[model samples]
Target: MLFAVEVAIALFVRDRFVRPYLGDVLAVVLVYCGLRAVLPLRVLPAAVLAFAIGALIEFGQAVNLLDLIGLRGNPVIAVVLGGSFEWLDFVAYAAGALLALAAERFIHR
Candidate 1:
């Protein structure tokens, strides 16, 4: 569900905020959900792992990982790996991770 919303925003949302910030936030939540689905990770660990993965990818974008590996020309890979870096993305990722953590605890408790 979150992944679907993220993809929809990616494909159609051209606004400055939604596509970038909200999409980034939801992307982290989606990753957290995926982690929980496959691994028996508790909420905090999973959220931390998800946030770390997002931060690592953001760093990768900062260093131009796509161009280094020669995949920058590929559109899909570019979208998946992200084409550029934004420091604001770190905030979004953190917000997402926290949202996921709170959501899990709320649902379980």
Candidate 2:
């Protein structure tokens, strides 16, 4: 499952590309799939929501949200919220959204 893969990447991988970019891409997909599993979400909306969530988190990182909330020192929060911001993350999120849309179309056809 995508969650398992995300966990594995988070726990084990330290590469420059896979851990960051690929993980981000899969993250959006995971979010989309998760939303679909629980809610009556359409594919495009789910993907958009997923990308929005990730982008919001990334913007949070840009503003150092965890530190402002006094949670930067918390390891769990640090991991979940992340610490750095990158424009490429937006690209990865978009890619993930498109990939999720494509996969949904492929699966339903």
Candidate 3:
């Protein structure tokens, strides 16, 4: 349902500014990590999995897999995915994953 909503919002909204807001993949990653932290899960493995998923999303975009799947290739998605070689998104993912790990520690305690 969430993925459907994201795709719908991305496709229906045609404004330039609205493009970026379609689907905040990075923020989603952060939220996913945050949830992991809140849950009783292994931090390292979960973080690694999040990082892998993020990387896959970016790489998949680079290869046009998303486009093939009917998802428009927007610059915003590219930007979020580290577009050619964006180190920032990776950093964001790492930060999110780490934050989730940290949050888990505090919450579990």
In the order shown, the candidates' Cα RMSDs to the true structure are 0.8, 0.9, 6.4
Q: Candidate 3, TM-score vs. the true structure? A: 0.52
Q: Note the Cα lDDT for every prediction shown.
A: 0.92, 0.92, 0.58
Model 1, 1-109: lDDT tens per residue? 7878987887889998998898989999999999999999988999999999999999999999999999999988887779889999999999999999899889989
Candidate 2 to truth, TM: 0.95
lDDT of 3 by residue, 1-109 (tens): 5545555655575673433432444355464655465877566777777777776766775676655665456656544453343445556657656666676679889
Clashing residue pair totals per candidate (backbone < 3 A): 0, 0, 1
lDDT (Cα) of model 2: 0.92
Better of 2 and 3 by lDDT: 2
- Candidate 2, residue 108: lDDT: 91
- Candidate 2 residue lDDT tens string, 1-109: 7899988988899999998999999989999999999999888889999999999999999998998999989876787778899999999999999999999899999
Candidate 3 whole-model C-alpha lDDT, 0 to 1: 0.58
State TM-scores per candidate. Answer: 0.96, 0.95, 0.52
